[model samples]
Target: MGHPAEVEVLSKALSGIGVDEKSLVSILTQSHHEHKRTIKRGCSQFFVEDERHFERWNDDAIKTLKAEFKRFKALHFMK
Candidate 1:
């Protein structure tokens, strides 16, 4: 399980990268640890402690992540 605050941070970060809330929720609920790890890694890679870091990611990176997130959502939903 993840802390609510951490989850909120992840949600905001995901949205910043173009993921929808429903997909975010599904990912968080179904594969909590993997999702948490991905978010943490993304945050660290982008130095994302808040919205500002989200804003700073290059457009290409954001686009790549959006694609990766879509794949994650599909895999998660299949389970």
Candidate 2:
């Protein structure tokens, strides 16, 4: 079980990415242990770290978002 403060911080960070609190909770709770571990590691590494680390994480996240958007648009036109 995660600490309450950690959970709250994670929820707020996820919200910044446009994820709703309920869905975030559901995803975190229902995911595999490996997934949870990875997320916990990433949250500590990216969110709680210094500003440089956060900026780097944010930049990579934006790149991933762009790639996903491109893939989504490509699939949208498929018959």
* Candidate No. with top TM-score: 1
lDDT of 2 by residue, 12-66 (tens): 7454444344545566777677767666764654334455555334456556546
Report the Cα lDDT for candidate 1.
0.60
lDDT digits (tens) for residues 1-79 of candidate 1: 4455655656565655455656556656766666576665545454434465443545665676779777878988999
Question: Which residue pairs collide, candidate 1?
Answer: none
The Cα local distance difference test for each model comes to: 0.60, 0.56
The residue pairs that clash in candidate 2, if any, are none
Q: Candidate 2: what lDDT?
A: 0.56
Off by over 4 Å in 1: 1-55
Candidate 2: segments with Cα more than 4 A from true spot? 1-19, 45-79
